[model samples]
Target: MSNPFSYPTTPHVRKHGPAGYREWENYRPWLRDEFDFRCVYCLCREKWGRRRSSWVVEHLVPREKAQHLALEYSNLVYACSSCNSAKSAKWVPDPCQHAYGQLVYVTNDGKIHAKNADGRKFIRTLALDEDDLTNYREMWLHILQSWKKHEPERYRQCMSFPDNLPDLTQKIPPNNTKPEGANNCCYQQRKQNKLPEIYG
Candidate 1:
């Protein structure tokens, strides 16, 4: 079975470049699709809990530090509330520029191990190795494993994309640098039957 906790092997390339949203909150839907409905830092999925309440639109560079980029699409990321709070005003490697899978690894025991200094800092900054997070990861790992083994349908539901994929085509940002990306959004892919049922 595919490990749901595995991180991306390559740095994320921006698929959407929406701009001119006055409030960063307006970018939540875009960020959700861009990051595959998970926390960019910790890999927490939207399926795990209440979506709107649990997830947040995070700034790659904190607003306090870069006020100009507060609404910039490139500077936005999708993160869980816990990771966002832990990373408040702190700098770590950019997820768009770094392949986290190369920097860190999540073991079967639910412990996160860093492969280098950057990874170490990333984990520390986000408190990714804390007891609470480890316990959370371990619990999910076991649940997913059991579901995959005994209840394949439930496992597919947990591993699959959320039902309400945002329709990016209807959204009109003031300026979209990559207008073509809208066609590749998860909603569009699902419409075309191009989206995979389960993402590893």
Candidate 2:
């Protein structure tokens, strides 16, 4: 996308010791609410399958360079566990000595494009292009596209829900008639997260 704000810094609660867990707890809910529990990188929503879900917090930058920014809400993203580990502390990849432009930051305008080596490497390193990952991403894109196409009115309604995907995923269907293979990865993970309860 375009320029976006940096992650919000949290200096007050992340002191040290056992309180670190508290810091995680403090940030998780707010961040999850903000991103609506969707993995920012792939936009894997609960309504979508969770096969690609890391279901963990991701730092836009490596934690080392921006440790102080750990709890910053803007720096955080709901990501599949794989993305978090793949991202590992190396937010960007090797720079060509004279590369220009700012590193990609996931703020309001952060689009999921890898423009530089570091960015591309991160994707490859994390296997973001893997079959499974691509499937989830493509599925979500289809949902977004479908909304834009045939169901304009309902699409507006979905957007109106704010955390539409997450909310929808959380809702459980009353019947047991899932699409044959729907019981696979994504749906299984969604059920684990109590998603069926949130969306039907």
Candidate 3:
């Protein structure tokens, strides 16, 4: 349950068109790969979230503050809408610059505990320990526990994949069969620059 990196590795941001939300939407597929199709803050996936907008393209620096970089790919992050909204226009340590795992830990029951002051600030700023998020993470933990108990092989496959729950939902095939490409669906989709079914 202990994750090593505070933030996932930063993906290369490809340059895109001039400033606009539409232009950023085009970069979602690429950004998804960089973020492993999970929210940068909460690590939720659109496939498993209650809302389709659970994961979205967020600007690390608000467009209102830095209009010139509105379409700058490097500034973009795929975050759950709730986290993005909670973070609205506030400046915090950049995940890329600040180590998150060192600052906070999500307990077995899903409450997030800050390891230090900055971690506390980050958690408080984003409401990382809010009831809804805690409950959601607890549910995921139960699902994972169930998978580990009842479907060990599947659980291992899912656990081995870096994308966590989404890897289970989108990439790992069922025990009895394989997909057409002999690959995880997400990998093929990424290869084709195709967004997931939800995005369609």
After superposing candidate 1 on the true structure, give the runs of residues whose Cα lies further than 4 Å from its correct spot.
50-53
Indicate which candidate wins on lDDT. Answer: 1
Encode model 1's per-residue lDDT on 1-200: one tens digit a residue: 78778889999999999999899998998999999999999998998884225888999899999999899988899999989999999997788888999889998878999999988988999999999888888888899999999999999999999999999999989999999999899999999999999997
lDDT per residue for candidate 2 within 6-94, as digits (tens), equals: 22122212111111332644545434544545555444454344563437767766678978767554455566676667667665322
Better of 2 and 3 by lDDT: 3
Which runs of model 2 end up more than 4 angstroms from their true locations? 1-21, 34-37, 46-49, 59-76, 89-114, 157-200
Poorest 10 consecutive residues by lDDT, candidate 2: 10-19
Query: What C-alpha lDDT do the candidate models reach, one value each?
Result: 0.90, 0.45, 0.61
Output the lDDT of residue 67, model 2. Answer: 81
Residues 15-125, candidate 3, lDDT per residue (tens digit)? 222223346675465456555666777766554645335567798899899987766756787788888899999876766666666777776676788888998899888
The CA lDDT at 89 in model 3 is 93
> Against the hidden reference, what TM-scores do the models get?
0.96, 0.46, 0.68
User: After best superposition, candidate 1 residue 137: deviation in angstroms?
Assistant: 1.0
Higher-ranked by lDDT: 1 or 2 = 1
Model 1 TM-score, all chains together: 0.96
Q: Model 3 residue 16 lDDT?
A: 21
